[model samples]
Each structure stands twice: as structure tokens, then as C-alpha cells.
Target: MALKWVKDNALNLGGSPDHITIFGEGAGAASVGFHMLSPMSRDLFTNAIMQSSSPTSYWAVKGTQETSARVATLAASVSCPVSLGDALLPCLRAVDAKLLTDQQWTLVNRWFDVPIGPIVDGAFLPSHPEDMLKAGDIKKTNVLMGVNLNEGIFWIYSFAANMPLDKEGATDKEQFRNIVLAIADNNATLQTELLKVYSKEFADAQKRRIRILDAASGDSLFKCSVVDFARQYTELGGRVHLYSFEEKLTSNPWPGWMGVLQGYEIEVVFGLPLNNGSTNTQAEKDLTKEVMGLWTSFAKTGTPEFGEVEWPMYSTETEDYVKIRTKGTTVARRLRSHACAVWAGHQFP
Candidate 1:
């Protein structure tokens, strides 16, 4: 769709890249991850960067048929589920502008029911992207994979900002809590399992429990899948570079700790920069230069490096990845191990 949109409307400004890069941030990164492994998307791009995303390695639905059924109703109501035969999608798009203005926050979670998404029909998106990735069917795309620290807290907080927390209505704080609760509730099993894991680390206070849950879920959902993506790519003799984003976070209303919360790099990526105010002045400049070297190199050469140090590809055997932080970048052990362990243990088929 990304390329097609460009093509369909005469976006062939200069024609395709001899090595076009298709990548995304968050779920958008999942699209990049899929492109890395998909035969359909192969010729479209030769390089991929999957930032802060890992497809369904974080959480898998038990009954997508039921989920699809629910989505189909919405699609039918809007005369959506567009295809060559289906003209009603245009009507739905007309409703889209209105829906954007009038739709409830809850509807955002119902994005699956909408026509535009990763379809499970086994046609376009055939299987889980990770499945194809691990089986090593993915194309040879130099890949970038990693997650932002505290990636989930803000997203969960933002998503839950409209819930009717007190029955009468939503206060700002209450709404935020509601979003957190709703998400935690939706993935109750994962939440419950995480609490069990984190209890070993921070054993008291619901706040601490929630924080721990955020960390674990952040790992399992986004972080691990990235590592897994690199693992598969490296297995295929493909080039891969992985990094963990850990720019010290800005101060919060709460007194003590600062944060590197979700999507913060979006502003940075857009060249809109801010300081988290956590580290010293020198550390800040160093880290900025390091990250710039990475992404810019990846963008330009499909290889991320500063000078003599070329970014190494990740291999399950070698178990190495870059730790992107407020200090500088350094290779570390296999990333998101706990996340991989959790998912592997759960889906043992």
C-alpha cells in the first residue's frame, strides 16, 4: 500500500529505488518486519528497518475468527471491506473523516475490525510475519531492530485517557488510569503472567507492580520480536543491526525518576528534539551523534556505523546487539531475552 499509493497517484517521480527501503515505527515497523520476510513485498524494497516493533511476538490472539466476525460487522455497516468488487469502501472513507471527529477512544482499539490492517486471510499477509521470518523465508534486507525504553507507559496512558473511570465521567487522571486498566484487562493473561514475573523483582505497591508490568510487556511485545527478527535475518546470512533506545527520560510530575517513554523519538526523527534532562551535557551530545550516525548511515548505506566500527549482524549463536543509550552505543548480549523466553515457552507447538 505504501508504494502502491505512490504509484497509483503518479508518485513515480523518479521511479523505484534500486534498493528501496521499507520500514516503520511501532506497528509501522511491523510492516517493515513483514517486508523483510515477505515474497510479495521483496522486490519493492531491498533494505528494512523495524523500529520498536515485532509483529505478534508480543501477544497473539486466541480467536481471530471471532475478532474478524466483529470487524466484519463494522465493515458491513460502513459498506467497507473493500476489494475490486466492493465499491462501498469509498463510502466508508467518506465516513472516515466524520468518524475521526466523532469516534470514541474505545473505537481505536477496534482497529482490527476495519478494512485496512494486517489481514489474516492467508492471501496478502499469509502467516505471522515472525513465522516466515524464523523459517528464514525473509528476503535479504539489511535490518534494524530495537525498542524505546518505557515504550508502553505513555501509549497505555494516552489510549486510556477517555474511559469512564468513575461511572459519572472521566477525569484526566482517572481516564489515564482507565486506559491502563483496560489494556491490562484486555491482555489479562499476559498481564497476570507478567505480574508473577515482576513480583520476583518489585514485590509491593500496585504502582511498582504496574511499572514492572510495563517493562515486561514492553520487552515481550516489542523488544523480543525485534531480536527475533534479527535472529532470523542473520540466520539467512543477511545483514542486521540492532539497538536499544535508552535516552534518559524527561522529568515527570512524580518527583524522583525521569523517563524515556513511548514514541518520544518520533519528534527526534522528525527533527523536533527535546532533552529528558537525565544526563550530563557531554553525554547528551555524544548519544545524539551516535544515534544520528546510526540512522543516517542506515538510511544512506544500509549499514550503520560511525567510523571503523561497522554495525555487526545479530546471530542466535553470537548473541550480540547494540545498546543505544544516553552514554554511547556498545555491543551487548542478545536483546530482550526474557521476552523471547516467555513467548517461546507459551507457544510451544
Candidate 2:
């Protein structure tokens, strides 16, 4: 309905937007990424700004039917005091969004982690988003996918605070290491590697490296689908414009000084001076203006250049993306890490 609405509206207005870019933050970005490949939305929006988030189709929450049944079965196994029946579950979608937010983030995690999704509900989202991307149905849209330099700093504070790298290191000889590794299905090798990456902070750190890991988390959680979309789309005659954000954030006098963390780019990308209690220094604002122009121009035209670099189409042959930073704007065919490359190789349902 969303894509059809856009296409129909654009057609009514005239031809589709030459650029037709989509803008979204957090889960909104995830939706935009998915919608790019969605059967209903492919050409509706041609360009996208997946700010601080991306397609997280790799993770799925347990569905209502399955989860409810499991909860019931588990309850029964424990001699559950509650009744186990169809009436037990009123269906999650029935709940109001406000109520869910007021209830806090566990529900959101359940939707993403417990249930494997966009969903296979047999209607709007009949199959997984990655399926659409893999089939090359998603290529009509170009993309400006990126994550903030401190994208995962919040997650680190939320989850990994008070823990040292060695503790976080799955390679550690500690039980805690084993526990964290078990979460990734006890892939000790991967866990050991993750410990090396997450637990160990190398001095060779580019400011964006940690963010890239969080971006990889976004990649694993949300970006894999779009990775497929970008790769397959270009391979099958579509275009994708990729970028990485390296905006500098002003540190405040808080206990811990966190920079442009998750969702912080929302203001910067749109060139809105945010209330981080810091002034948008002229240099920062200049960079902000540059990005906003590129983004909105792409939204209006399907290209991301606003008197910037020559916007290139992402092709299988030329696997590169324009790197967006305060220092410069250039087409970087590769990042130091193979995270995005590795992500593109996964199989989608």
C-alpha cells in the first residue's frame, strides 16, 4: 500500500520522482530499506537515507502463534498456573503502539529477535524482506545507506557497560565469555573472534570502526537484506548508492562523553541543529548542509550528488560506495573491514 500509494501519487503528479529518495531513522529506516525491495513498493521511492539503521531481516521474533504456543508449553512444563488456550493470546498487533512504548523495549526486541520477520503473514509481507531483495525485485531503488560514527555506543552502554574487553571477549577463559558466546549459538570460533573485536579495542581504531561494528550489528540485524538488495539489484539492472557517515559529535560534560551515537545523524543529515547542548559550529553546519543537500536532492532526483561528487550507480563490477564525511566525499570501493562484504554472502529465505 505504501509503495503503491507513492507510485500512484507520483503518477498523478506526473512521472515518478527522477530520484525518489526515502528518509527514515531507526526502525523507520529499516522499513524504508525493506520497502525498497518490497513487491508493493519497489519503484515508489527510488532513493533512501537509512540513517543509523538498516534492514534487520536476519533476526526474527517468535510469531504470535508459535510464541504463544511455546509460552504455553513452557508454562505447562512448569505446571503453569495460567490457562493455555487460544484465548491466551489476543494477538500482539492488537496492542496499541503507545502502550508498547510505555511498556518499554522488551517487546521491540521480541518483535525483532523472538519472531523472524517483515513477516510471512501471507498478505502485504507475504515473504521475508530479504527474499524480495534476493529475487532482484528491490533494485529499482537507489540507496544512501549509512550509520553514525557512534551508532552502537548506546548499545554498549545499555548492554556492555561495566564490562571490560576481556570479560566481553568470548576467547576469555571465563564462564561469562562462554555465556556471551552461547548467545550466538555457541559458535566458539565466532565468539572468540567477536571477543577479539568487541572486547579488544585496538589502537588502530578509526573513529568509525566501532560504529561499523554496530553498523555490522545493524548489518546482521537489519542490513543483510539491503546488502542483498544492493548487490542483487545492481547485478540485475538496478542502482544503489552507498555511503558511510563520519560526522563528529561534540562531547558534553556528562559522566561519559558519547559522540554522535545512534540516531544522532537524524538532525545532522537533515541539517537541523540538534539540542545536544552544543552549538553547531560553522564547520559542523557546513558539513551538515552538504549532507542534507545530497540527501534531499537524491530524494527528489534519485541521485545523491548536490554539486558533490559524480553520483555513481552501484554495479556488481564496481563494488564501491561514496564515503560521506566532514573531511571529504569520495567513492570508497571498500572499507577496511569485510563486514558488509561478508554480510552480502548470506542466504535468504
Candidate 1 residue 164 C-alpha distance from true site, Å: 15
Write the residue-wise lDDT of candidate 1 on 161-203 in tens digits: 5533232222344443433344344455654555566556665
Whole-structure CA lDDT of model 2 = 0.54
| Model 2: residues with Cα > 4 Å off, grouped in runs | 1-20, 43-46, 60-117, 161-185, 195-219, 222-228, 251-259, 274-278, 340-349
For candidate 2, lDDT tens digit of each residue in 1-349?
6556666687677766444566787678777766665555655665666764555445432234754544554344334333555644454335466753344333333212432234445454555555555565454655676555555445544554454443222222464453344333445565555545544444534433343344435445544444544566567676667666766545322223355556666667655654455576766777778877877777776677755378676666666766666677777764323554444444322
CA lDDT of every candidate: 0.58, 0.54
Highest TM-score: give the candidate number. Answer: 1
Return the lDDT, model 2, position 11: 60
